[model samples]
Target: MASSRLYLSAKSAAALDAELMSSGGFSLDQLMELAGLSCAQAVYKSHPPESKRNVLIIAGPGNNGGDGLVAARHLKLFGYDPVVYYPKRPNKDIYNRLFTQLSNLKVSFTDDVNKAITETDQILDAIFGFSFQPPIRDPFVQVIRLLESTEKPVISVDIPSSWNVDSGPPKSGELGAAFMPDVLVSLTAPKPAAKFFKGRHFLGGRFVSKEIAKKWGFSLPDYPGVDQIVELPADNEKL
Candidate 1:
C-alpha cells in the first residue's frame, strides 16, 4: 500500500544519487532542474494561480536552495509572482547563476520573512536539505519561527528544516519546532517524513532513469502524461 511505501534515510538517499548519476548516466544539474520544475508544477496544482498568485520562496544555503532559486524562476514564468528569501546563499557559481537568472527576470528578493508572508499567499520552504540537523541557528531560526507563527500555507521542498531524514521529526517539542508543510515534495525518494505528512504529497525526481530504478529497487507510480509531478496516493490507498 502507499502507506507502506519505501522510505530512504539520508545515507541511503546519498548513495542512490551516486549510483544513479555515476552508473545511470544522469547529471546533478538535470536532477536539480527536474526537481525544481516539479515543485513549480506542485505550486500551481495545489493552489490555483488565479486565487493564489503571490508566493514567498524561502531558500537555504545548500542544493535545496538551488532548487528554490530554480523554482522561483519557473514560478514567475508560470504566471505567479514569486519573491525570494535567501538568507544564506551557497558560494557555488551555479547558485550565483540561478540568482542572476532571477535578477534577469526581475524577480525581487526579500530579507524580511514577516513582511514577505504578509505579501505572499503561500511559501516554498527550501531552507534545508536531507542533511539538516535540529536546533536550526541564526537567521534560519528566525525565518522558520516567523513561518510557524503565521497562517500562510507552506510547501516544503525535500525535507523540512531541521528534520531528521530517517527518524521523521527531530527530537524536539512538537516535531522539532519546525514549519509543517501544507504540501510536501519529496525528491529522489520519499524520506521517513512521508509517513508524517497529512497534506498533499508529491514525489519528484523523474530524472531517475529506468536502470537506476531497477538497480536501486524503487517502484515509482506513473507521473501521467507530460506533467512534471503527480500527487502521491494517500496512506489509505493501495500502492
Candidate 2:
C-alpha cells in the first residue's frame, strides 16, 4: 500500500511556516515553543532523564538554534541537566530573550564544545534546518566533526546539520555514516531527507491546523492523549 504520510520539500515547508503565522494566526515564538517542547518530550520518551541526564545541545545561528535554546529550557524542566553550546549567537530580540530564560534556569552555556560533549550523556543536534545550504563553514565544521566522532546518542532536530533537506546526507564524503543520528525529531512534518535517517524517528510540532493540513494535502497521525510527539516507523521506502 502507498504510504499516507507526506514529506515536504524545502519550499513547501517554508510556505507552510509562513501560512501558519499569517493564516493560522500563530506567532513564531508560539510555534518554536511547541516545537521545542515536543522535541523535549520525544527525547524524554526515547532516552529518558534517568538514562541520559546530562544533555549537550549544539545550537547554530538561525531559527533552528532558537529551537535548540527552547528545547534546552524544556529539557531542564523535564529533569534533564541540559547545557548549551551556541557558537554563533544571533543578535535578535527573541534569541536574547531565550538566552535570558535559559540563564535564569541556571543552564550553563559553554564555550568549549569538546569539553561539553565529553561531559554530557547525549547530544541534541539543532545546528541546521531545511534552509541550510552547502559548504559547511568555520566553527561548525569542527562541531560537526566532533558530533561525527562522538559515541553518545544524538537526537537531531528537524533535518540533521549539513544534510541536504531533500537528498539526505552527502552521498560520498567524510561526513557520512558516522555522523548519522540515533534519533530524529522532525518538526511539523518530516522532510524528504528523513527517508535516509536510519534511527528512531519521531514527529513533533503539533500545531498544524486542519485547514493547513487540507491546504498542504497531508494528514498527521493521531497523537495519543496529551502527548506532544509520536514515534514514526522506520520504513525508508514509505517516507
Once model 2 is optimally superposed onto the true structure by TM-score, how far is the C-alpha of residue 124 displaced, in angstroms? 0.5
Q: Which pairs of residues collide in candidate 2?
A: none
Off by more than 4 A, model 2: 1-5, 174-177, 236-239
Worst 10 residues of 2 by lDDT: 1-10
- Model 1: colliding residue pairs: none
Cα lDDT tens digits for candidate 2, 154-203: 99999888899988887666564357999999999888898888989999
The numbered model that scores best in lDDT is 2
lDDT of 1 by residue, 1-239 (tens): 34334677788788887876777677877777888998898899898689899999999998889899899999999999999999888788889999999999999998777788888999998888887866678887677677667788889898877677776765556534555778989897788776766788888867776766656656667787888787887862433
Q: What is the lDDT of candidate 2?
A: 0.87
For model 1, give the RMSD to the true fold.
2.0
Candidate 1: residue 99 lDDT (0-100): 94
